[model samples]
Target: MTDIIIDGGTLTASRQDRVVRGLLLPYREECRSNIGRFSFAPGVVEIPQDLTGMSLNIEHERERVVGAVTELRETPAGILATFSIAKTPAGDAALSDIEAGRRVHLSAEVAGVKVKDGKGIAGSLFAAGLVEKPAFPSATLLAAEDTSDDEDDPQGGDDTETTHSESEYVDEDGNVWRMVVDTETETDGDTTTTTTTVVEEVTENPDETTDTEEEEDPMPATLAAKAKTPTPPRGRTRQRPSIADDLPTLYATVAQARAGDQQALTLLAALTDTKISGTGALPGAGVLQESWQGQLWQGKSYDRKYINQGTLGTNISAAGKSGFKMARGTKASPKTKLGGDWAGNKTELPTGTANAEKFGSTLARWAFAGDIAREFFDLPGGAELIEAMFRLIAEDYAIWSDEKALATFLKLAGAPVAPKTYPSEYNDSLGMLLQGILAVKRAKDEPSFAIVNSTAYEQLLYTPHEKVPEFVSFDITTELRGTADAGKVYVVEAADSYFVDADDDPLVDEGEPAVLVGAKAGVEFDELGEVPFTIDALEIAKGGVDRATHGYLQTFEIRPESFVLIGSAPVVGG
Candidate 1:
């Protein structure tokens, strides 16, 4: 059994806001903890000045950080903080437990503690945890209702009250107060709130008031009246149209709908209650992908340029200029007379030079074709099932493109770039990236982008390094974890780099930016014959093929001198 602590602690969590806010330590309130009786005063315990990255875990598990402390302040209640929960599964579960009136205790993991005379003194809160049973029983988690979710909402648009709940609290004087808030809304958009707080004498057993269960229920009159209203019987009202009934029909005709089947198209129109086009072209991947930009990877690869052909040449001229120089020494400066013939003392300047390099790009064809049995369309949820399949294929394609681009970048670099080692004071991932950027700057190029695996990026987010200039942009993708090692950072000068779609030329009159005038990725086209070609073979008798063929033609160019690859990217994957 875990020891419990009760030191006038208080905590509240708001699932809608994704935040857990409460008193961390009860100042001047003595509490019995697992380590015996301990309490804190204003100056007894020291906390981090900035609680920016403090982890909030579960059951004191160091590895399962579910949230981070976003706000903290010292108050009469001891230390108060607002923790923003992460969107991970554990985080969601913890918040749900809190909202559902479970796992109501919070435990503080303090470090550097010096216990003197049964009191903890001079310690820092290293982190906090959400536990089923905490050493401090008063550190209970309360469901904080969003007042804005009620009427009295300042937004004024909706008069309908959205939420109603009751909560209890223990004041410093040990008075138990039950708070009931009633929000009434009218059709005219008027909002009002009635709050009633009933105080009760401190009972012999504080657990009766502190525990969420076995507590007195102070029902608000307004809420009681609303609850007393008889609920209408289910299904007596007219039902709204739902697409569930037509799912089978839609699935059966989905492929034919894309192939311009009149019967299939008509059924789909009636099912969806909207007219679909007769052009034989159902919504392509673009429809589902539009919300994520042209291609998922391209959104992150912003430093892109376009070219029409597979081969291109670039010329880099030498920086130094050639010019005639006169003798500069005091003795030889005036040796040549103005009117004299060409003299031997005149010095000739070296000739300027430039280097030209031609590079060719080859198109890599990637196609995703998924086949579903013809009978699948007749099954429930087949439409969604097929879409999910294609979605996975699309995601795989995105990862492949991302890895391919990283590989191309690494290949252009020819060798791993080592940033100038920084002093111990500036030793961090962000510092390394800064040094890498400096290296690129020394090459007469500007470092505009940095690419790192998601793991490295997360470290960069918390690294205590000097502020990076606004011009330098950093991006993270999981694919980089495979291409570039998780701990590696790749800083590059990609302003002039381009992703070239060499398939077709741009229309000069369209006024499209030259950078965007090319065939984008995620394109679907038929084979030499109609896509999902009808097979006269016996396999057709089993069930017709349900296939989607998607392919794109594109290549990219990153000049050898335009990028600097920093950190370790193990050459392992194909």
Candidate 2:
């Protein structure tokens, strides 16, 4: 029998392989065999654990001891020696030129060949030397050897596995057994089959039977192996189900789309726009404008009016008789009455150069980084950008817009000059507000709305805390844009009310100024067939090269009211 030898080991720079030296050889104990004193496994030996200060004699020459053996251990093959080079001048020079890797050639010797009584050839490692550097990949630790049954392990010594024939003659005390074999037959008007077989002795001695150990064949390298999928046997898919009846419906729908619906055209346009815009956002740009999403009128420019606010007709609910009476002397008729421009008599919308700006970076990188289009509407600043554009316009508008509606509502409320330079807390401040509401009701016979800044509204909210006598308990009904228990003083909150610093009207320089407005008092925003406030995209460029991502807002006839100035507190230092 030939001995098995594996010649690979590890020597890391850390010098940590001490007990691992036992891996180089199979581990077995010494035993007193019938032949004499010897070991069942010869390579097993006690090895030194620490050799920290011991020097290594390269090829048994003390003159070449460049490094010290820091650690050593007994392994299956031989003792593992871990060493490190000294940091001396000579050691450093030697290490600098020495190539590093571990797979040294080791010498081995066998004692004798026998089975029982330890007669089998026992392999033993004798000498180990560092020769040429190894070419194969190395690891920090040695691999565990295949420890299957000696006769069955694929490494060597096995040939018991077979499958072909079912029966063969065996004169073993009337016992029957299956014999596996293959046969071939040739015919020239004659047939023949041939096979190979061997007979074994029924031995009771262990030493004699040990010689029958079989060797296993090596595996083929070219074949790929995988776990077999489990399934119920006796099943096969031979045919497919039929669905020919549904074809007519599909064809009819296609034909209908081609002739009537123009679905192909719609699909083409949608796909083209999506590709060009690269904005495959979800259904809507989900933005949270909870303050005022659907509060105001959302209609086309044609739905608004840009005519004179002072001359606008009040005949919305004016009554007249277009029907004639029978047998009446000249059929009694009454003329339709029109009211003068009592509200917004001089509330003029000023026209100036439109101010606009853009603040967005190029989306070229984000657009090309991913294959899918990102939904901009879902982003933090996505759809809100449209609202932001309008808000910018509204901010400037709030600064200079006339307060015609406010003044008109106040006059109807009998508080025409109630907003004095130093008006009482709720006496005139809140009283004038409620009175104006009631006056509009008396004159127009309809309810009136007042819009104020959030700051002034907050004050009204804490009016009772300000030690006021009129306010019992005012509640902010943001949803209704008014107060709950405010009786007739219905107030609305303007998110962008404090957008300006101070009003330049010169009427009053009071610190806080507020504007009050009615629903039907302001001029209208109208265009031929477009929305009053529209958001459009522009491909801005400087020298014919598209520069940045920008948006445009088109607002028409957007005139705010003439802001009213609030009175400062009474000076107590008399």
Candidate 3:
């Protein structure tokens, strides 16, 4: 069998009273498998829903049951379920491993699957396994608390949970049989289906009941109500709009407050909902006065961008140079040892010429601006509104600047690596990343990092790989524009800009979807003049002020050989 590899999150434990909780199955999360890419939507798993009696096993082995699911609820993120660890030695060990950071993730086992568009649209969650590696990054084992004070209580602590029970008895053939019974009931319309999983673990010696190995029956006992009519295929279900769905119009609110409208000012104050100071400024003055200039303070936020010349490569001052020049060295042999014919005869050394080229950066002005009516200055929240507008523009510019940086880098990265088409047989994004890293290494530069769009990054987390090279790291950006282009990732030695796509025309086979790479030192970003937030009163007739943030990005030197662009087949149903 082909080996499975996955990239994702780590299991973490935190003290939260006596109960253990975590995200069980993340909804709409896709993962790459040996067969291909797959994921589970909210309705895929069919069960009693609460999964009260669902067993928790080790590596999907039902016979090695360690615990049972006690509670479950559907959450926006996914299904959040709680587990009741059994009191057996195996259960104790599993719990100990989880709390000690030994056992890391959870993997769900399902049966009777109905797949559509690479997702488990319909299936049954038979059991969940505690494994070292899991397919879903969000399938975390958050915490496991031992409810039983007496860790060695053999009755398995009947007082805490009644979802499942175990009993042992000797058969006529002098064999010990351990019976695990799970009970659950659910009603769909008028019909109710009751499921009971009775697993038998056989052992020759009663003392070895815990050590004995067994396999669960291929099919569990399920009682179904007779159908009165054939059911139709499931279709899309409608969801009610949520309270947060009603988005507020911040621009309108700010505009009205600037006109000295009391109602608008009150509404704005309520929306901001903070201490307000009426110093002829906008309501909730503190928040409106927050500054977003000079630095990317929101860099840690997922929506904010942090990539730039300095981040990917060396950032240097323009130093007043219109263009930078460098020589491309041609391969030449070293001089032969000066032996035998030393003084009189001299042999000509291998000669090679170096090509000199000059490269210059491009300068472009970028800013975000807003216009406010003059009357807004009369209201207390008016100044606050102006400050808020400036903050919004600054945040927007920060994100846009990164997108421009990435687009420029892709253009200058040059052609894609040789044999660029990722292996068609493998639907693994992580594999494609590994290929890109190797390609950069072949170019004689150790890859420093890689960047992929958010979509491709999700694929990477699900695509199972033996191991990701420790030498390089992965970075994700929302700015890697284009739907089809999102499937590609670039491995780099550093960074540069002004990219030329390797393939002008792409095919369904996934060759050259998009190319982006280069050395950072090769690119120069010069912010000319001050990026000041300025406000100017408009013409008297207009009676408004134009607020803008002004700055220019100038100069760059690109080195194509320092980066490799890897592309994969666009994921189906993505």
Candidate 4:
């Protein structure tokens, strides 16, 4: 015989025959019913002595048949049997039918002997092998008994509670078999007393057994004790203040008012009026008052008496009145106050000395004209003009011995002499004139000629001339009123135009107008079209031939004027 432990319990079987017989009986009955044959109830039938091994056959109603068997066991009570079963079919119909909770029948056989209802028979045999029954509390019965005790006690004494607590039990399998809690309350004089008792049943593994099951570590005694105690009274959680809940209709009313509903506004006004009456002041009243009295009223006229008369309009009216009075009191002609008449009449004003003083002022104004012109035109020639004017004055002073003449010359030259070397009044006037000239020049696309001088001419002419290569080496000639000396008049004969090419010939007709070559690495021509040439040499053939030679052969030829070549080298004879 072999001993076997069931799930947390023990059993025994003595022989293989008994084990097989015990397991197959239930399945045999199931097969009989499934095949539509005689129904059979499985019972304690002895295993056939000829049996070798156990087998099960499951037959689906309209499908196929399948089966499996538990491994044979020998225990003190009988064979302890456990196994799984499934369906066999060409399709998955048997499995699908089983999963859908359809009933299936299974048959069991040991060797040549068949048993009925094997599953039920085996389950009963396994149950009979347990050495002891598992103990568990009946929760419903316990609760009912406690209620009955409380009812019996009426006032509820501590003795009944203690008796309920002491009836708890625990087992060695870590299962709580029973637990009870009891409370009693007593009052005397001005004091009230309450007592509570709790009992729990706990199970732990035996010391001789190795505990494969995990144990929950005990909580700290204080913590466990605290957990068993009742909680103290506390007020309910506070609710958050919700704008929507407190003022349910406020948002909707605002939306309606915005849609031009006057009822909402009227309601709001009534509410405000009621609040104002209760408090003697409206909310935001100061803001409303300021908005109406200061902002809104100030934006519009309250009365015509306080309306503004603009400063410009008043000034214009005063000016008109003064103009009218002056027109009536004086003659129709506008008179020059300095003794020059409006009519063709010259007044007998101050003579020589007075005239000289007046003339001096005029000359001073004129002398500053150059500075004014330079500033107005934005030209560097302002200083040049002033210098020229001063030079003229100095020359005049040297020629004329009279102080008055010298003074007059200085005035006309616009060079202030003495006390004010540069006149402040003239300086301001010059600045204004300079601005005006610059404005005119910008609009007209023409240079201001107000302060022309040699430096100015040189800048305008030569500066631009440098941009045109043809004019770079040209001896420009202009007619002179005096000397005709070769050095002074005609230094060397040359055209203000020239050709540019890789060779001296310029690869163009000699009679053609000069073509300008751009700074880009290619030669361009106005009359002939683009020339395919490189600047290999430049030659000055004075009073002779200008030509180019390739190797020993003449490639091009040209006639020459007074020779001068500024760039490249001279080509030998062609």
Tell me how far the alpha carbon of residue 238 in candidate 1 is from the true structure, in angstroms, after superposition.
Answer: 49
Q: For every model in order, what is the number of clashing pairs?
A: 5, 22, 27, 26
The digit string of per-residue lDDT tens for model 2 on 107-193 reads 112222232342224443322322223211111123222111113435443233211222222222322222121211222123222
lDDT of 4 by residue, 1-574 (tens): 1111111111112122221112212111122111112112323323433332333322211222232344433221123232333333522443333333342211222211222322222222221111112111111112112221323345444222121222222233433333333334334334444344333323443552554444332211111212234432222221111111222354465476568765444221001122543354546545344333322222322111100100011111111221111211124333333333344367455322111111101111111112123242245545555444444443333222222221221122221111112234333222222332333334332211122112222332343333423312223345211112221111111122223232324322233211111111011101112111112222334222222211110011011111112221223453
The alpha-carbon deviation from the true structure for residue 477 of candidate 1, after best TM-score superposition, in angstroms, is: 14
TM-score of 2: 0.27
Q: Model 3, range 14-97, lDDT digits (tens) per residue?
A: 233222334455555555342344556655565555665688777655689887877554433345445677777997788678
- Model 4 deviation from the true structure expressed as Cα RMSD, one decimal place: 39.1
Q: State the lDDT at 512 in candidate 3.
A: 29
lDDT of 1 by residue, 1-574 (tens): 1112232233467777787765566554445432334466666666787777788876666698999988655543356556899998998998888777676555666655554654556667657767665333334324445454544536755455433333455444444433322333343434343322211112323543543333432222322212322221221111111112233443454466457665532210001112334454466445544352322333442222111111222221122112222332234243323332444566554333333334433454566554567655667756666655666666655555444554454445444444455666643556556665566567665444454433344555554524544544444344321122323323322221222213222111121111110011211111122211222222376675646544333443534555555544234341
Model 4 weakest 10-residue run by lDDT: 551-560
Off by over 4 Å in 3: 1-306, 309-324, 328-344, 349-355, 368-371, 415-427, 464-466, 469-518, 528-532, 535-543, 568-574
| CA lDDT for candidate 4 | 0.25
Off by over 4 Å in 2: 1-68, 71-74, 77-429, 438-447, 463-475, 478-480, 483-490, 495-574
Residue 503 of candidate 4: its Cα lDDT? 30
Whole-model lDDT for model 1 versus the true structure? 0.45
Order candidates by TM-score, high to low: 3, 1, 2, 4
Task: TM-score each candidate.
Answer: 0.29, 0.27, 0.36, 0.12
